[model samples]
Structure formats: C-alpha cells, structure tokens
Target: MKNIFILAFLSVAIFSCGPGSKTIGDTSSSEIATNDTIKIANEALEYEVIIVEPGFDSWLISQPPRGYYGQTKLESKNRQFVAEYNTRVLNPTKYSRNLYTEQINYDAAVDYGYEVNYLLYNYFMYFQEKYNEKFIGGRN
Candidate 1:
C-alpha cells in the first residue's frame, strides 16, 4: 500500500514539475494577499492560467520533490483538497461533490491551482463575516 502511494506520488510530481510546470505568485520571500492573482504555466498544457489567492508561496516551499522517488507528494493532496473544497463550496453531500465539475474544475486549474483556490476560498469566507471585500471569484 505504501509503495503504491509512493508510486502515485512520484507520478504526479514528475508530471507536474516536468516541462509544462510553472511556479507563480509568491515565488519570492514576500507573501501575497487573498485577492492577488498571478498567471502561471499549466501542468498539462502550453498555455498559462490565472490563480487568484494567497499563502501559496510558503505552502509550495514546504512540499517536496523529496517524497516518493524524489518528487512532490501531490497524490496525497486530492483527498484532502477535495474534502476542503467540497465543504467550503457547500456541496449537497460528499458523493455529490466533484472536483472536476465544470463550475469547479480543479484539473483544468491544476493541483496548485486547486490548492490555492481552496485556501483562498476558505480564507475569504472566514474573514467575510468581519470584512466586506467579498472575494467571490477565486474558488475552483
């Protein structure tokens, strides 16, 4: 089981960081806010996509190409990301939630995209009760 998990993580990391991979937004020492958006290369395509969120700079730095075959452990993120996304989006139920749906297509946004969206969405939602900025468009 562990080997399978490791193999899967290796595959995602390899494919993600390959030729089409892109690192965006907080690539620097400084951090970005919830409303900031940046364009980055797509993992499966040649074109770039926009990601509107924050905190990704530090999060990505902590992850690895050190897990499973010296690659990012992206495979482990889906279950967690999906769960958080579903909860934040207020899905009718766990089974009804689909991360790849047209409205919240995480695959098109890519793993990093999905991750940042989840983070931004939850952050904005948590803060909107006190702050009125209403960052509504960044979610996956």
Candidate 2:
C-alpha cells in the first residue's frame, strides 16, 4: 500500500531536521510483539496511514467508537488540525521540530472514507494529549 501518512518517533538531537530523519526509540522484540502500531489501509483508495506511536492504540480503544462522530465532523476537525499541524511542520523553529516533523497530506476534496477520518481525528487528539500541544482553541 502507498504510505500516505506516518507518525514515527524521531531523534531528540537538535540537528535532526527535515524529512527522513533518524528514528529514535526502543523497538525491542517485546514491543514489536504487542499491537503498538496502528495501520489503516484502503487498497481501493491506494493510500495507507501507519502510525507507530506507542499508547495510541490503547488510547483510541478508550475513546468512542467509529460511528460516535459523523464523518463530516471528523473531516472538519481533521482539516483544521491538518492545517495547523502543517503550519507547525513548516515553522519547526517556532515549534518542536521533533513533534511536527512532517506535513500531513490531507485533501478536503477527496473522500477518505469514515475509518480514515476517524483514525486521523483521534490521532490528533491523542497527539495533543500526549505532547501537551494544542492545534485549535477551545477545549483540548
């Protein structure tokens, strides 16, 4: 599947800038055996989103189900989050380079289905809570 988005762990060094930066973190056999990776694939759409952030899977499980939020709502929130996230990615000097390393390629014109939007929305929520970063105003 074509990789459309990925949230990988990056090194904490100051020089770790730009895409393709070295990934840091322990991926021991024990961690790999667990469901630490979240892969959302849509073969028909020829796109895939692989999120390898620890605790994301469990956090998602604790949240509401897929149908809890409408696709339109998810898409709206995703658009806002993606916009702010991309801005941060572009201005890494003003933000944490390690946290916002890559820009998310999300198009409002395309229909990414409900599952993808749901995961992306939740990922943003998980990201904010984990990193203590807020992309939008109001409640986190």
Candidate 3:
C-alpha cells in the first residue's frame, strides 16, 4: 500500500536580519494571536492535510461555509493551487521560502472528502490574500 501524507507548514511571520522586525498583514507581531492549526486526517485512507498558520482558523470561519462549493470544485481548485504552491516551494529564491515552507502532495485520484477539501481550499485562499501571492491564475 502506498502511504500518502501531505503536511503544509506555512507561516505568516517574516524574518529579517536588521534592527527592526517585519510583519505580515495589518496587525503587528505582538497583536497577532497564537498560531492556528487545522488538520484533517482520514484514518481509513491513511492520508492527512495539516495546515499550521497564524489567524487561519478565524480567517477560515469568515469564509464560505462547507458545501458552499461542490467537492469536485474544491478538489479541482486544490489541485491547481497545490501544483503552483509546490512549484514555488521548489524555487524558494524566486518565491518567499517562509510562505512556501514545504511541498504538498495532493493526489487527484484520492477522495479526500468534503471537510478536508474545504479546509485545504480555504487555506490556500487565506495564504494568497494574506501574503499577497497568486498561486494559480484567474480567481482565487
């Protein structure tokens, strides 16, 4: 059996080698709350998607609710986003290494369910808006 594991360690923090520090978004580093971790694991399928980023939980809640988009739509979008994100991961010099920390292994044939797809899709949107990045073309 092939074990499929997808772990995405994306962060909102900016590192600088200077006197002052840099931050993402409006809120400063101090004002921003603790990091949020959103994980969806399917024991039967032996695959999971873990997203650890600051303010993702609240941001996700503010977005459209589950079932807002069909599973196939979400999967399709996720596939595109994952492909672009992985490309960025490979070229850290071109892209921000902090944002694209790791590569995500998303299989199109695998049925990751609604919950997993929903969270994964939202996370990509959040990352794009927050970091000012456009993974795929067209609408987010």
Residue-level lDDT tens digits of model 2 in 24-91: 65456567646678788888878899888878887888999979999999999999999999999999
For residues 1-140, could you state the per-residue lDDT of candidate 3 as single tens digits? 12322222222132333446555555655454434766778899999777777889888878888888999999999999999999989998999888778899899999888898888888888888998887765255
Write down the worst ten-residue block by lDDT for model 3: 3-12
TM-score of each: 0.28, 0.75, 0.72
**Candidate 1 residues 3-91, lDDT tens each?**
99999999999888855644663244343543345555655744454544455434444433233221132323433444455455674
Q: Write out the backbone clash pairs for model 1.
A: 65-71
lDDT of 3: 0.79
How many pairs of residues collide in model 2?
Answer: 0
How well does candidate 1 match the true structure in TM-score terms? 0.28
Q: What shift in Å separates residue 113 of candidate 3 from its native position after superposition? A: 0.4
Q: CA lDDT of 53 in candidate 2?
A: 83
The residue-level lDDT of candidate 1 at 67 comes to 32
Single out the weakest 10-residue window by summed lDDT for candidate 2: 1-10
Question: How many clashing pairs does model 3 include?
Answer: 0
Error of 2 at 3 (Å): 65
